[model samples]
Target: MNHTIIISKRISIYIIGLFLLSLGATFSILAGIGVSPVTSLPYALALTTPLSVGITTVLANFVFIILQAIILKEIRWKNFFIQLIISFLFGFFMDFTIWLTNGLPEATSLVLIIVYLAISLILVALALLLYFTANLPTMPYDSLTYVIANTWKIPFSKAKITSDMLNVVLSLVICLLFIQSFGAIGIGTFIAAYGIGKMVGVLLHKLQPSLKQWVYKNN
Candidate 1:
């Protein structure tokens, strides 16, 4: 019974994390300034394609999983398949959140823009907190960086930076080739890419003790 309870708790945390992550990403996209770097490519694709950003995100993340498998030169078929299911769930949650907020007016005024940015940052930080705490199957984009870092024997931080830069570059290329405009890549993209980590770090630092206590007490 104890083991079952612990497993249930962990699964609940993971589901909450996915929910917050999808909502946060939707908030960023709806902000209309731009999306985070990890999402930039998908957002760009959505502009030219008929699919919504949520659907494009699922497809892009699937490709990321395939790339990770290729780079690792070995695949854990079970985990790979599980991650695909999680990715689809995340994508559907994102679409649902976007639908919920579809009636929100576009952020136009200076105050509204700042408010949107602040909300986006906070929600993303909270999402990261839940994600790291759950200790579940890793997201595909994150797994790609991990696989690359291990394969190249480079620092994970360096590998992650490289991955993000590559994502931005790829998004730019897609924009140039198809849209002939850079509307999807803007200041918010860079802010999200860089600021979110710092925000998550600070939040985790401040909340770690309390979070630990909660987990231990629950256990």
Candidate 2:
């Protein structure tokens, strides 16, 4: 019963995290600035193609899972399938959030854009921390970081940095190729690239004790 309760709590937190994650990303795109580095490609693809950002995100994350298998030279069929399910859930969640946020007017003023970006970063950071605390199956994009680090025998930090840079570059290429302009790559990407980690670190530092009590221990 105890274990079941723990699992239930974790799943509940994970679902909340997933929804917030979608909300954050959607706001970033609609802020009229660049989306986060991790999301830039999908944002660009969504702009250039008929597919929605959510659909592009799902397809991109699916590729990440495949790339992980290729890097490991081995596949855990169960984890692969779990990640597949998560990818779709995340995609659908994003679609719903996009619909919900679509009613907001576009951010135009510099201050408003900054406000939007700030909200985006904060939600993403907090959502990721909640998701991690839940100890659930890892998201495929995040999973690729450790996969690359282990495969190359490099530190996780280096792997993450490299992965982010590659994502931004590819996003830039996609924008240039398809749209003939920088459609979804902007200053906001750089801000998110650095800000998200710092925000996450700050949040974890501030909330670790409270989270440990409520999330991982007796509430």
Candidate 3:
């Protein structure tokens, strides 16, 4: 009974984490400065195509899952299914958050931009806290970084950098060729690309112990 309760609690935290992640991403998008690195490609695609950013995010994540399968040469079918479900939920949460905040004042001034950026970073940090603590089926984009690092015998940091750079490059290409707009790739994109990880790390260092205590109190 204790084990089951623990599992249920963890699941709840994971779901909340995913929701927060989507919320942060939405803030970044609506900020109109730019998006985070992970969402950069999808944002670019959405700007050019008729698809909404949420749908594009789902499609992009699916592609990442496929890449993980190819790289790992095996698929954990159960975990893959869980990831798919989570991805769908993430996409939905993003769309829902966007809709919820649609009436908020426009992000026009430098102050709003900074506020949005700070909010995004804090939310992302808290989301990461829940996500890593839950220890659930990994998100495909995150899994890909692990697979690449393991397969290539490189440092995980290097692998992650490469993956991020590739996504940024793809986002840039799509914007240049199809959209002819750079609106989605701005200072915010660069900030997210270079700073989010470090910020998450700092947050983790400070918060992980308290979070662990809270979640594992019964253990």
Candidate 4:
């Protein structure tokens, strides 16, 4: 496939992915659950530094990009731009959703909470679907762990678990220090995201049509 054409076709996917990411963040906020690691990092840094969340996220993403380039030399123009778009759009949409979802009661009843949780699950599934459908490149955090595992002869599953644990700890501490209301709901959100993402990947794989035509079209 022509890289340029693929980029054109996938740009909407990237945009919708960002929208889903932001939407997920909004749902988390509404559920009063903890935020994602990369998302939380910016908020944490913003608290201690003079930088805005947007700026901090850009810096963090760029650092990851550099690390990824060093560890895996597969960096290219298309992937680089995709990474940039992901980071920036995620930050921007997160803020937007936060503002939009604010002022609505968190959850008035158990049913409402369940409803919120269900929506969150769906949003996360959509995020993963769009993310992979972009067919551009994986995020640096994900790629970094994979590369480190392969290079150092560590178990990939173990590496991923360790990384996720670190993120959970960091997010918990930040939420605590900031006095954010992330409790069992936060854990639930994490589990739901994991489950939904896995399901999406499985389903997409099973349903993926032969790409000959799509690839040819892009070419």
Which 10 residues in a row give candidate 3 its minimum summed lDDT? 210-219
Q: What is the C-alpha lDDT of each candidate?
A: 0.83, 0.88, 0.85, 0.64
Give the alpha carbon lDDT tens digit for every residue of 60-148 in model 4. 67766776678666776677677777677666776677677777787767677666766766786677676667765666566667777
Model 3 agreement with the true structure over 1-219: per-residue lDDT tens digits: 767877887899899998888889888987888898888877888888998878888888898989988988899788778778877888788788888879878889989988888888778878988999998887878888998999999999999889988988888888999867785788898887767788788878998888777777776
Q: TM per model?
A: 0.94, 0.96, 0.95, 0.70
User: Can you list the residue pairs that collide in candidate 3?
Assistant: none
Residues 48-120 of candidate 2 have per-residue lDDT tens digits of 8999888998999988999999999999899989998998999999899999987787898888898898899
What is the Cα-based TM-score of model 2? Answer: 0.96
In model 4, which regions exceed 4 Å deviation? Answer: 1-6, 36-82, 177-185, 210-219
Better of 1 and 2 by lDDT: 2
Clashes of 3: 0
**Candidate order, TM-score descending:** 2, 3, 1, 4
What's the lDDT for residue 17 in model 4?
Answer: 73
How many Å off is the CA of 59 in candidate 1? 0.5
Indicate which candidate wins on TM-score: 2
Candidate 3: lDDT over CA atoms? 0.85
Question: What C-alpha lDDT, on a 0 to 100 scale, does residue 154 get in candidate 3?
Answer: 99
Model 3 — TM-score against the truth? 0.95
What TM-score, to 2 decimals, does candidate 4 have? 0.70
